[model samples]
Target: MDAVAKEIEGLTFNMLTFNVVNDKITQGFANRIIQIIEKHNIDQVIVIADEVEEPAQFLLNLASAARSICISQTCASYWGGEPLFLGAHELSWAPGMFERKMDKLFIDNRLFLEFLDTEDIKMLRERLPKIDKKIWFASTCLIHGLYGLNYENNGCVVQSCISDGNEVERGLISITHSSRQDERFKSLVKLREYHFIPYPALACYIEY
Candidate 1:
């Protein structure tokens, strides 16, 4: 197996390739995967490696129940683009600004159900039953009844932040540059085993 495949096997997360020419799954890869699985008490995992010009769609299969989700961005050494996908919904994006009126906020469900590719969802459900249970959206995306698809399941809960029953995706911005001045991000880190999702420019904020 190649170095990349070996490292992936060591992590014990299932591997999928995108637009990569070397599509060889060597015996070494299978052996290493078994060894890692035997060594750890793992419940579920899904890992994806992308080598194409296409967007990183593998992120859509992230383990929501997991306390932390790690992404090694190979696109541009820096991260920044489309503040969307920072919510608890599958194949959905949050609005730019939330309008609040009469103590109740108006957050629309801008769902592209056409993006709900049933085959992909089925594949994920088969591999990881608890997929997309709770998403790692930004604390800012929290607007009432704005949880996109996550709400359809069972409302939603915010981890590592204030526990609000609202279904909004989030709009809580992360403080950048001054690590000392960012109380909200600091508080989030204090929570036990919080989920880790990365925004392009805000990727630096995730301590772990």
Candidate 2:
């Protein structure tokens, strides 16, 4: 039992969940989120709730566990509370966009968590404007190609992964390899701006 517990101790995961509704975000909803996290031993989470009225209080209530949080751009007025400087940004993009491709929201939210966890604030800030286009997981290659143009001018794309450094490298290299053979992937990296650092392979944002 002790050995099993030890093994479990090493396991942790970043989670993402959305409460998409027209009603205001409430404390009960927040509590339920905490319950779910504890139940799964979640290390971190990205809570995406929409149309929160008291954004400040809602966030403050979650101050204990929510390592990285995001509210919709439409909720801007309610966010007048003290900002945690935790990548608190306006979700100015169309809701339908995220509704269709939820994985992109998960990735975008986790990117903020990674920046906070790795203390790569400067890189995040510098790349913030560019993220909306490149990091967004589009449903089509045409979108990827259009965004790839901006990605090249901005330099390299760096992102976090669940695996070790070498694995990250292999994954990225695989993508580049596919770019050569797959028409969609090919257009995405046409500029060769596909140069990317899948850290912890690069180990630090400075290397990007």
Candidate 3:
């Protein structure tokens, strides 16, 4: 984990993702994120909810977790809460001319999420003229490509996975490796890497 984070921090455009949905290495997926923030000395973070099973819960935690969290102000309104930074100029790109060959939504309904609609994205584009784009920052979210999960220079992509084990049994980590270019995995590979693998493999994130 230390190595992974370091490699990411070294990026020309530094970035990383968290499967708040699942921790690919130890258990306590929730606390593990908090630990990562402290361990890596991360100052700000973005939390993206892949599914809506618990948006409020995640947001509440996110609110408490970051130094100050910034979300799509529109999504905050849709969820009925005011975010610290409600205006994200980047939200402007409402997705266009998708080249994906699968799914009818790819052609017609590109907006994609419950709270994220094309209209909000369009509105964001309108306000973008005022926001400068020269800043470099780290983002942690479950959001798809529009959120910038892929590291183009290295041709590296961020992936996530979850386990289906019973409540009593610790679930295995689900590792979905895909091209950083693909929005969410069109397909996935489930490995017991999270709970089953040796933690040393995660030399990328942890210190010896």
Best by lDDT: 2
Candidate 2 per-residue lDDT, tens place, 117-150, comes to 2223223324433433433221111111112122
**For candidate 2, what is the lDDT?**
0.31
Candidate 3: TM-score?
Answer: 0.26
The lDDT values for all models are: 0.26, 0.31, 0.28
Tens digits of lDDT, candidate 3, 66-149: 442322211223423422222222332221101111111110011123233335433433332222221111112212223322
Ranking 1 against 3 by lDDT, winner: 3
Q: Which stretches of candidate 2 lie over 4 Å from their true place?
A: 1-13, 74-208
Where is model 1 more than 4 Å wrong at Cα? 7-52, 61-136, 139-208
How many clashing residue pairs appear in each of the predictions shown?
12, 1, 12
lDDT over C-alpha atoms for residue 16 of model 2: 40
